[model samples]
Target: MTVRIVVDRDKCQGYGQCVFEADDLFGLDESDTCVAAAEVGEDRRADAERAADVCPMQAITVE
Candidate 1:
């Protein structure tokens, strides 16, 4: 199964907690807004989930 990471920009506060959990999958752009990879490999599913869990605004969705 292909893993995907989705961030709800409307709800995100750019706190960067997701970046700490999975820097390779998520990051803060020059504007300090939350940014994430659109998709990830199965091996990195856990990392994606962790990042989702840590998002303070609950703006992340893992699929």
Candidate 2:
């Protein structure tokens, strides 16, 4: 199954914590903003969840 991902740009602080927690499902470009994968595989779900939890601004969401 595919997972939905969302990153709240307003809440994001460019910390890159989410990227470190879930590189396969989240990342930061040169601009240092949180980016989410449109569709993440099941194997990456756990990491994605962790990313969401670790985000200081709670900028990431998975559905």
Candidate 3:
């Protein structure tokens, strides 16, 4: 199944932790906001989950 990722921009601090944890699904933009690095796939679900886990702001949700 295709994964859905939601990042709460207001709660995010742009720390980039999610980017490192899930490079295939997360990134930091020029504005330092979190961005989707790529469309999420089943194989990348774990990475997405890890990103959610490590997000200090608790701003990421995956479904």
Candidate 4:
């Protein structure tokens, strides 16, 4: 199984909090915007959920 990660670019503020929770799943781009992987193994669901939880803008969604 795999979980899907979605980040709302308009709602994102370039904060790297998600990166701290899961570097392999999230990152900052050259423009300082939040970038994230589209999907991850079910084993990483916790990491993805953490990233979403810490998002100040609530820009991240995991499903």
Clashing pairs in 1: none
lDDT of 1 by residue, 1-63 (tens): 779888999898899999999888998888888889998889999999988898889999999
- What lDDT would each prediction earn against the true structure? 0.90, 0.84, 0.85, 0.93
C-alpha positional error of residue 19 in candidate 1 after TM-score superposition, expressed in Å: 0.4
What is the clash count for each candidate, in the order shown? 0, 0, 0, 0
With candidate 3 superimposed using the best TM-score fit, by how many Å does residue 8's alpha carbon deviate from the native? 0.7
Query: Using lDDT as the measure, what is the rank order of every candidate, best first?
Result: 4, 1, 3, 2
Taking all chains together, each candidate's TM-score versus the true structure is 0.93, 0.86, 0.87, 0.95
- Deviation in Å, model 1, residue 53 alpha carbon: 0.6
* Candidate 4 lDDT tens digits, 1-63: 889999998899998999999999999989888999998899999999999999999999999
Q: Per-residue CA lDDT of candidate 3, range 1-63, in tens? A: 788899988899999999888676787878999987445778888888899999999999888
Top candidate when judged by lDDT against the true structure: 4
Candidate 3 structure, TM-score to reference: 0.87
Q: Residue 2 of candidate 2: its Cα lDDT?
A: 76
| Selected candidate, larger lDDT, 2 vs 3 | 3
Which residue pairs in candidate 4 collide? Answer: none
Candidate 3 deviant stretches above 4 angstroms: 37-39
